[model samples]
Target chain A: MRILPRTAESGSYAALAGLAPKRRPSLTPYYFILPYLVFFVLFRLGPSLAGLGIAFTNWQAVGTPRFVGFANFEAMARDPRLGDAFQNTVFFVLLTVPTLIVLSLALALFLNQPRRGRAVGRVVVFMPYVIMSTVVGVLWTWILDKDFGLLNVYLNFFGIANVPWLVSESTAMYGIILTTVWWTVGYDMVLFLAGLQDIPHELYEAARIDGARAWGVFRFVTLPLLAPTTFLVLMLTIINSFQVFDQVYVMTSGGPGTATLTLVQYIYTTSFQFQKFGYGSAVALILFGILVIVAFFQIRGYRRGLKGVE
Target chain B: MSRTISRAAWYVLLAVVVALVLAPALWMLSTSIKPEREIITTQIRWIPQNFTVEHFQAIVQNYPMMQWLFNSLFTATAATLLVLVLDSMAGYAFARMEFRGRGLLFMIVLSMLFVPIQITVVPLFILFSRLGLTDTYWALILPVGANVTGVFLMRQFFLSIPGELEEAARVDGASAFRVFWSVVLPLARPALTAVAIITFLSTWNSFFWPLIVTRSDSVRTLPVGIAQFLSLRAGMVQGQMSIGQSMAGAVFAALPPIIIFVILQRYFIEGISRTGIKG
Candidate 1:
């Protein structure tokens, strides 16, 4: 918690040394940045631009790539598997985003209380997040097993029949969604807790002085003040949900008839599995488009919400 | 009396949440230690009956579990160190120096945040293949150096700290590199810790690129290896691993980080919170 004061005169020493006036433009900055810039261009920036170009070409693992303008995009229009991937992805996002937002916020609020064991509670809740994604998926697949899973065993105590979580097409996406919420909800909760701590104590006191009850205080003072965090969490959750692949790859492999097929899964299969690099790049671009468009509307709606609050 | 009741209820709620969160992990541990006959039973067993270490021994003897663990540790540590050096130097330049294309270069870096890694994976694979670097540790570690978040976090951190110390060192005729290394970097420990933890955790947990790039168990990481060899649908060559063995491998893969996390929980939470609020 080192304090960094903002008002310190930054470049005064150079001025005092008379080097500020006529010092040659130094290559020092470039030298410092060159190593990272090379990596950025080669690995990140270059690949990203090349991926865009790849979308319009007929690239494959073992063939010369030819420029085929809009062919891949046109093919995506008629691709039934792509349609399923897109729909299932949207369905997954719909199921996950609100559930995660509400659940994590609830957990955050509950843990934020001044209680004796809340620290332990916070640590326990965030524990699953520390496990690798594949491990979480593997572990949950066992927990959600149809016959002898812990979940089914508990359900049967209440006279409920066992549900085929990953094997059944109808419930496969739900299984991944359940695992995801358990795996990542803690992360969102941590973010929400940080947001909760940032709200001034006097705001709550003011609301209480006005005779507001708990729900009323939360709805007005807490919710409105937490708008930015909520927006950020929402945006991050959506982007992440759109890119959901690891759990699906391990748990379902987009199976039980592509019930859990998702955008990134499609990208992986198309490019890596099928070796249709061009088509995969096209699908990846569609994912990027969806994210940018969704972000645009979210920011717009968030701006409107801010204006309303003001 | 009402306050006492509320306090009791609060503990009850906390207990329930903790149980729900921990049950799956506990189940993995339980099943790993249980004999196969007990594991396949319909009864709910929190504690294993006739507990055994046979499954753990089987996985250790049969698979390259230990090798995958070593690869994951080595690659993630290397990636973290690489990111720290590259990002801190670049971040210093961005924050304190007047340079050509400084604004645009940083903007380019930041804008990549929105571009999904899936978009770049294919071309990157191609690049690696061309360079004959595929299926190596270099393939696993190099691309992570291009990560954007560490650079952004470092830059933000450098901007926050007062520049007087670095300026004074420079005034005393310490070269820019000397000033950055000796003066600035020592003060950057907090940001460095945050970045290091985040990068290490993510790399250790990373599955996608590693899954694509590494072909054999020698270079295969834990996540990829576990998914490929020990999963329910264990890959073509290994055949399907038994549930008991799968859980055993999982416990082996999961315990190290969980232990580290419990010890370093404060830094972990602080690092995540900082990234969340700022980024």
Candidate 2:
């Protein structure tokens, strides 16, 4: 629990670097951060680079790195599985992000009310978010069971047939989407709830004084203020939605003929399950590129919105 | 009148949302308690008619659940502790210190957050396989030790504090580490707690890393074990198991984060709120 406060008297950063005390006692910060960095480079950056290397070479995990440049990427271009994975991953992001944002904002509104049970409700809803994805998959499997699940059993009175929630390709991704929404909405709700609390009461009163209706206040006032949080959550949700490996692995295994096969899942299969390091690495790098581009567009949109505000 | 109309609509919407969210969880709980006959029944009942705890009793009595619980709890705790110490130190340096390459270094680490956790899986496997670290707790704890969020978080939090406190301490001839340990770390409680809660929860909930690393039930954590339980083709338990056992596992896995949040709900919100917005 040591902290090193480098005493830099000069205002300039360069001056601080030269003028600060030589003995940085918490130089331990470097060491403190060392373990993580070592692992990061080794596990994260190393493999990612190795993955890049492997992509260029026909390197399986067990084999020599014989160069077969551009072949893996070319194969990816032709691979129908890669194409399906891309579509499904995009579909997953599309389905989950909007629903998550909507549900989170709605719940945040509910929990924002200064009511007796509001706190309790907030904690309860947030409970699911904290659970492991593995546990979530199992719980949903039982709950969404076609013959034995609560969903179809409840639907029995309406004379609806039992839906093959995770079995059929058409419905399979939907099941994953629904499960994802339930699991992650609470996290965003908490964020939005925090954002809502930050909005001053004076704005609402001011809107009312201007003869603004509830919807008017929400549209003009609340929505504008919540944009920052919405932006952040939306960006995170898109990233997280694309990175759906654990649930797919646990629940569907990208199954029922590749309906739920996300790009990351494909990467997983190639790397670990199929043992094609080069192929997996190339797919991973592409997925990484896609995510980076998506992140850029989102931030661009956010910046554009911010510019409008300014 | 408008208030009344909107309020009614709000209630209906909230009701539907709550039902949609709670139905799966409630069903898991119900199925957990119901007998195999009741579970497989065509009729839907919210309350289990059989209401048996046999599955729970079996999970506890028949399985090595206690070990799994201990393993998950201890590993998560250890990881959180290490992260707090190291992350805070690095965070303080990145925020307060006039270190070389600090901004660029911080940017690199921050960008790495988007590196899909899956990207690291292979090299880690290769690395651990070489290190002979497989099946050990160190394997589970080390790779995830350096959390970019924690470092970024600590740095931001330190910057927010009035610098005069550190100035005052340093004037009194306090060393940097001493200043951070005694004066700064105590003040960063809210931020530290935020990092700790998320860290512990994620660590506890981690399945993929541990699944790849640990060999058997002896070293495996709760989530992986439960996943194995579901995927088990062994001894095809025809009517031998019930939903209760899985629910109990879910309850075990889910309850800790809920309780931790209950204990520190304010800090929990503060943590998430700060994560993205802060530069």
Highest-scoring model, TM-score? 1
Candidate 1, lDDT over the whole model: 0.89
> Model 1 over residues B153-177: C-alpha lDDT tens digits?
8888988888778757755778777
The window of 10 residues in a row where model 2 chain B has the poorest summed lDDT is B231-240
Cα deviation of B157, candidate 2, in Å: 0.6
Give the per-residue Cα lDDT of candidate 1 at A2: 26
Candidate 1 regions exceeding 4 Å error are A1-21, B233-240
> For residues B182-231, could you state the per-residue lDDT of candidate 2 as single tens digits?
98899998888888887888888887789778977777898888777653
Q: lDDT of each structure? A: 0.89, 0.76
